[model samples]
Target: MNNFFEVENVDFVVGGNTKVKNMSFSIEKEGDIVCLLGPSGIGKTTILRAIAGLEKIKNGHIKLKGKILSSEKINIEPENRNISLAFQENSLFPHYSVEKNILLGAEKNPDNKDKKVSFNEIVDLLDISKILNQYPHQISAGEAQRASLARSLLSKPDLLLLDEPLSNVDQSQKEDIQEKIKKLLAKLKITTIIVTHDSYEAFLLRY
Candidate 1:
């Protein structure tokens, strides 16, 4: 019954319109994957953004592991929250190769650098080893999505928010990628929330 992540009565407004109102939810356990299923423009992505500190919550609070991240009176900067949000849009640095992009935001602490997973290990886990030397523009959509996902994972966030993560993945590769990602996240014991429109995928993930 201990909640590790909590969103309490969060309200987000855009241009005088309430995009997200009175929303409350919690993730109670480490490595628990929660899927938000709803139609587009229903504030699902907005909720994720609010939790990650990308969007300001007009009312109420967001907390992770008992640390306050967002509230009406106080807001932590996105970078300091230690939460990584992978958008539906490809966020890769165009000039960086896939290998460089994935490692760009990794933890820089020298003390535990050896403990972190290596570039080769992540690329292999995401099944993106073959495209490591290629640029963002040189890769396919599915490949770019995989690389972006890898980049988010490399940051070693306390919480991970994925917005329609598998949208661009090929249908044939979707299930396999999902399984790999699910297994990897479980192994890392990272609390994650994934936003997707497909109910079937959500059911599969939640089950």
Candidate 2:
């Protein structure tokens, strides 16, 4: 049988240069975590963006659970794709508390009756219960990253694209966060693709 998720011959261009040229890969099972590793400016993040529908693909296609998401003839809107992307910059709402910020994601996906976890379950799973009332700037980089992750996972996305998930965390906290995230992804069984420049971090995320 074929894999549950696939990216076939995807080509992405930024400016005039080709970033991801004919890239292809797949995840064979649910709850599997995959990592894309490369040097800076080598299109790792670009691939994730393309898979999440944030960037348009110039060629080839991306499929989730055997459904086509992007191609030359068809393109699905980001929100309608049941895909979520969490970037390295920590795109949290400074005006909203952590709980409120995450709640927004859960609200958007109310149509998804397949969601197996509740909002409070996600917050507790991410260990952000203590900082639920804190604003973005009031929390540490690690805390902010966790909150952003919680927001993404709360939606119970079919595909989770994490661009440098630990980039905002301190070096000392990378391993702990990576382990926690790995466990949570496995528990939730949300197919995930992670982009990272650190080889050690990639190794730590091994299933």
Candidate 3:
């Protein structure tokens, strides 16, 4: 049986240093959530970047739905990959309100008729409705993270990659937000790969 997503013997190098070497993994089916869990600065994020087509792999193959996305000779552009990546830093636009930032994701493909989730649904799920008008600087770090996630989900990506999604969330509300995100991904049946340094988070998201 073919896997839905596969990364085989991949190497990712940056600034003349090899960050990830000979890594291999796969998500066998759609709607599956896979976590890359390890200590910080161990190339977990690089793997996600490779899969999302943001980083070029030095060797090996990254495949999605039986199509080769990246290899020694083939590198697909990030925009053409139909993948959404939510950065760890919650890279929201400083000038735009939270609502506008989130809406930008949906605007990527205005002609797409089969949206997996609506704007209201994502806002409600992530509990960011109250802060829609607030700018990224106006909200807490946790709120910014959720807003970033909301934007990624709204894009209706074939593959969603989240980088340390809940890292900035308070411990008190971390699990709650994780559960909500897990359920939302399941409901939408989105194939997801989350990069996290916390084993507990990996367990929560994967199982």
Best by lDDT: 3
Off by over 4 Å in 3: 110-115
- Runs of candidate 1 with Cα error greater than 4 angstroms are 108-116
lDDT of 2: 0.83
TM-score of each: 0.92, 0.89, 0.94
Clashing pairs in 3: none
Alpha-carbon lDDT, every model: 0.83, 0.83, 0.89
Worst ten in a row by lDDT for model 3: 108-117
Best-fitting candidate, scored by TM-score:
3
Q: lDDT (0-100) at residue 168 of candidate 1? A: 92
The residue pairs in collision within model 2 are: none
lDDT of 2 by residue, 1-105 (tens): 878899999888666567878988999997788989889989998888778887788788888888999997889998789889987886998899999999988
lDDT of 1 at 164: 92
| C-alpha positional error of residue 16 in candidate 1 after TM-score superposition, expressed in Å | 4.4
lDDT of 3 by residue, 48-145 (tens): 88788887888799999999999999999998998999999969999999999999998876666655678998898888899999999999998999
Please give the clash total of every predicted structure, in order. Answer: 0, 0, 0
* Ranking of candidates on TM-score, top first: 3, 1, 2
